[model samples]
Each structure stands twice: as structure tokens, then as C-alpha cells.
Target: MGTLDEIKAALINLDIPQVQCKIHQGLAEGLSPSAILEKSLIAGMNTIGSRFKEGDFFMPEVLVAAKAMHTGLDILKPLLTAVENRVKGTVAIGTIKGDLHDIGKNLVIMMLEGAGFEVVDLGVDVPPDKFITAIETHHPRVVGLSVLLTSVMPQLQTTIQQLEPYRRELYIVIGGAPITQQYADKIGADGYAPDAASAVDKVRELIARN
Candidate 1:
């Protein structure tokens, strides 16, 4: 198999060491860093994401695959030229206040990064004002809110309301265990994702419309 294919397989298999080794080999074989990222690491993450969505893969598997992907990325990041480092867009993501869950949020961030978008992780228990600050400071094109608790679902609506002024400037995407398309629409969110994989697709679609 080609070095890129080998890298992808190793990553899918959660073979971190092999991922790192093949990435170095790809570099030695004159493969550009951007090629290694898009063709290998990102491609492998895409498969992992799909498997997770299909129920063939669980959180542990996805997490390990993400680690392998990040390992490959770490090797390539420094070698990428300025032009090759260009990102598709920026996304600021966080778990809504009163919701301490972050596994879903972290997964979404990983998928977004793998898809070539710069991610700003606002972490768990993020208040609406914090999200507002992220938007003001980072100027992201997309904002992601994650809520795992049914009781805290109201926080999502409150946060969106606080971000109303910036509504025209960015797209709001919401997700998590208790979140749904109906809830998103009711709360005036721009999009809804059922999982991390879908979040990347939704973000890409929202960005494309602008």
C-alpha cells in the first residue's frame, strides 16, 4: 500500500506508533505535510467518525483513533508551510453552562480539526458570556453549543439569545444528548447535529452558504 494508505490503516487500527512512523516515512519519501494531513490523518478520522455514527465503533475506539490521528498531525504540523496551513474556517465550541459533560464536545472538536477547520475549545460549563467573548475575540464563523443534560437544555436557549446580536455574523450549531432538530429550531439555532461526525458536516454546510 502507499504510505498514505498505510498511515490511514494504522490510524484506523489505533496504532499510534505506526501512525507516527509512517508519517515520518511519508515525509522522507517527499510527501508534503499537507498531503499527509488531508490524505492520511484526516481521511482516517473520517472513517472513524463514520464507524462511530454507524454504531460499529464506541467511545473508547473513537478516542484511541483520535489519538493516533493527532499523533500523525503532530508530526506534520511543523512541516506545513504557511500557505498549506490555511484553515477552512474557525469554530468556537463549548458545553453549555450547568452541563459538565465534555466527551461529546471534545469529539466534535477532534472531528472539526480533522476536517481542516480551526477549533476553539471553550471547555465545559461555559456560560453564554464566555461564548460571547469567544466570538468577539476569535471571530469564528461558526459557534457550537453542546448540552448533555435535559434540565440544562434551557441554558442553550439562553446562550443563543445572548448571542442574538452576533447572529448575522456567525452560524450557531447545537448538539448533545438532549438536543434535537426541533429544539434547535425552537431555540432559533441555525443547525443541529446528532453527533460529532454530523457536526462537521453541518458546520461545512453552514459555511458554504455564506
Candidate 2:
């Protein structure tokens, strides 16, 4: 198999060490960092995500696969030029204000990064002003909000309200255990993802719409 294919398989198997070794080997063989990232790591993550959505894989599987992908990325990141890394659109993501939960948010960030987007993770319990600050500073095309608490739904609403005045026509996507499409619509969010895998697809769709 080709080096890229081997890397993809290693990622799917969650073989972190193997993935790292193959990435280095590929580099030694004169493979471009961009080629390794785009053709191998991205492809593997996409497959794992699809399988998770189909019930063919679960969280543990996805987590391990994501870890392996990250391991490979660590090797390639420094080799990539600024221009290449900036090819994908930027994204700012966080758990809504008053919500301490972050597992979901972190997963979404990982998937976003794996898909090539530059992710600015604001961590958990992010206030409306923080979101606004990130948007102003980063000028991301997409903003992802995650809230796992029912009480924090209002916080999400408040965040959206705050963003409206400073908005540059950016796409706002919401997700969490309690978040639904109806809730997203009520809060004026542009989209809602039920899970991390779907978040990647939703963000891609949002990007396409613009």
C-alpha cells in the first residue's frame, strides 16, 4: 500500500505509534506535509466519523481514532507552511456561559481540526463577550457553541443576542446533550449538530452556503 494508505489504516486502527512512524517515513520518502494531512489523516478521520454516525463505531473507537490522528498531526504540523495551514477556514468554539461541561466541545474541536479548520478553543463556561472577542480577533467563518445543561440554554440565547450586533454574517452552530434543532432555531443559531461527527458535516454545509 502507499504511504498515505498505510497512514490511513493505522489511524483507523488507532495505532498511534504506527501512525507516527509512517508519517515520519512518508516525510523521509519526500511526501509533502500537506499531502500527508489531506490524503491520509483527513481521510481516516472522515471514515471514523462516518462509521460512528452509522452505528458501526462508538465513542471509544472514535476517541482512539482521533488520538491517533492527532499523533500523526503532531508530526506534520511543523512541516506545514503558514499558507497551507490557513487554507481551511477558521472556527471559534466553546461551551456556552454557565456550562462547565466540555467533553462535547472538545470532541467537536478535534473533529474540526481534523477536517482542516483552524479551531480556536475557548474552553468551557465561555461568556458572550468572550465569544465576541474571539470573533473580532480571529474573524472566523464559523462559531460553534456547546451547552450540556438545560439551564444554560438561556445562556446560549443570550450569547446569540450579544453576537447579533457584532456579527459579520458568520454562521453560528450549536450542539450539546440538550440542544436540538428546534432549540437552535429558537435561539437564532444557523445550524445544530446532534453529535461531533455530524458537526463536521454541518460546518461544511454552512461553509458551502456562504
TM per candidate: 0.77, 0.70
Q: Model 1 off-target regions past 4 Å?
A: 27-39, 46-60, 79-88, 114-116, 195-198
Runs off by more than 4 Å, candidate 2: 1-14, 22-66, 76-85
Instruction: Indicate the TM-score of model 2.
Output: 0.70
Backbone atom clashes (below 3 Å) for every candidate: 0, 0
Per-residue lDDT over 26-121 for candidate 1, one digit per residue giving the tens place of the 0 to 100 score: 889998777777788767877887888899999899889877866776666556535446698999999999989887788788667766789999
Across 1-210, the per-residue lDDT of candidate 2 in tens digits comes to: 999999999988888899999999999999988788778887788788678879999989978887787777677765673535564788899998888988668767866775678899999989999999999999989999999889778888888988997566589999988888998888789999987768988999999986
lDDT of 2: 0.84
